[model samples]
Target: MDGLQAYGAGKAGGAFDPVTFFQQPHAILRIINWLFSVVIFGCIANEGYINRPTEEQEYCIFNQNANACNYAVFMGCVCFLCCSGLLALDVRFPQISGVKDRKKAVLADLGVSAFWAFMWFVGFCFLANQWQASKPEDNPLKEGGDAARAAITFSFFSIFSWGAQSFLAFQRYKLGADTAIFGDYADPGQEADQGPYSAFPGETVESPPAGGVDGTAGSPVGYQRQEY
Candidate 1:
């Protein structure tokens, strides 16, 4: 079966194919997420701070709100790490022998991806608002403005990418759930050997008495002999 159809099936110990792995929709989204994270955090870390000749220490570029810059950086860094870990897990997913484990992994991916998507939405809004409120005097040379815009733009993109990841993970979860439900049903062919009371094949059945209930030879129950 194709890899997408085989998702969550937990068919283990298959040969690893790098080309196919990279070509998967899931893998492509993850790579996009990873790159977006790098862009967000890299921009903030490199150019989020600016200083004037009169200032002794660097101040954040987004209206001098350290919290805004910190929040973006934190989210970006954590997302970067999560994408990396998930990519590694994806590489090893085919080797997992347990369906439950694969299900758990997919569920985790769903939850984490959804949560990050929301967070990136918040980050985008927060950064954009702060950038708009920034005073021109705060950045005399207009330094890091492009970086700020890049961070905001990529944060916006990350929301959709992560959301897409969540959607894909949910699909995998559903596939696994369906597989588990169908697997629990006894096969029709296999049920032929199981009797109504679940009696197994070759089981001995008790036989009734050969004669009447009274053990009389050729005598019926209602015909009792009279004393003559």
Candidate 2:
């Protein structure tokens, strides 16, 4: 009756490790990266090209430019995107599942991967096409700086995005035919035997440490009211 067993993502699932198979962290990381892209990228785009030296000022993403416009809007969009992805992955919107939606998600994942790939491609061309400096006018793009930044961003997204998708695809191939796909699976040694956040009723459980054994304990972050 366990899900992901054959059809779901349990024992019947394809792999024992969902993190490697599904790349849960990488997927979550995508959301975080996009967050920076939105807040940082969009803000710079809005400021347009300032003169050159002061242009670095335009590159600034926070403060003075933290208004609800430009970068703020882009960051909001990225936030919505990541949140939506989490909801889907968590099945929080099971009531809204459909083939079209699933396929769309797949395509979006692929598209992002391809975009990152293209960015790297362009960056390579930048280095490849560097002009010889006989006269000082060599290498027109002055893009040396921009090229480096683009390369760094492109590398980060390319590796993470494509790597994650590659994992999903490989898992499907490995366990797709008569195999199981598990978004999540538990290991008795790793998971709590009680259950989901399982705490036995009428039993007081000892708290875990911030970075101690299994790291499962600790109160919720933020201010805690003390008892009188």
Candidate 3:
């Protein structure tokens, strides 16, 4: 019976669920999904299934097909390799009283992540473009327009991945927003409950019982001050 009111429909304290709030971070979910989808897309593009067998078939799923899979693997490798650098940034800097320290940490990590992202972008960009520009006669996998288009598309996803990860890195690692993810940290009502509800820390809350010193009805906590 008592538990019913504790969790019942009310605006005071029942709505906020702390467990679910801290356990989940939505930003991480979206980027991982995007990375996986792009990888699979790369693999299926050219039909290079297992081994690069110069065949004249269209439905080879288990052989070296030299299709989208080859390039997808290539793109996935590069993107994750760069993403790995973000681990360093994800570490936190302890709070200092006067001078700020967290922001400095983020700036430091940003420098490292940006470097890795740039290197990965350059290597992937050059190779992908070259492969895209190659004539089909040289390699039956991708050539001319489709090759270039696919390479460019993959590059776009790669850049997006880096940028997305980089931006999220600032909030969690550098900005110290991660500490406040669950919110204020102090007691939720401690700030606003300063007047009647909370007198001062260690201060007594003395009040007469039901019919007070003035013998009048009172509030829930049993109190009645002189009216006149």
Q: Candidates' TM-scores? A: 0.80, 0.35, 0.37
Q: 1-228 in candidate 3: lDDT tens per residue? A: 111211111122234444543243423533453464355345445433322257544432322234434545565565455444433223212212211344455565556546545644664565455554544454444333443344446555555555555565555543344333433367657555553545668564544468555555564354445698
Using alpha carbons, what is the TM-score of model 2?
A: 0.35
- Candidate ranking under TM-score, highest first, comes to 1, 3, 2
The per-residue C-alpha lDDT of model 1 at residue 69 equals: 91
Better of 1 and 3 by lDDT: 1
Q: Largest TM-score belongs to which candidate?
A: 1
Query: Mind giving the per-residue lDDT tens digits that candidate 2 earns over 1-228?
Result: 233232223332233443553455545555554554453344335432232353443322121222312323443355446545643553321222342343344445445545544543443343223312112322223423343344334434544554564355344334433332243344565456453554666454554547545444554434355899
Better of 1 and 3 by TM-score: 1
In candidate 1, clashing pairs total 0
In model 3, where do residues sit more than 4 Å from their true spots?
1-26, 33-75, 81-109, 140-151, 171-228
Give the higher-TM-score candidate: 1 or 2: 1
Candidate 1's C-alpha runs over 4 A off are 1-6, 187-228
Best by lDDT: 1
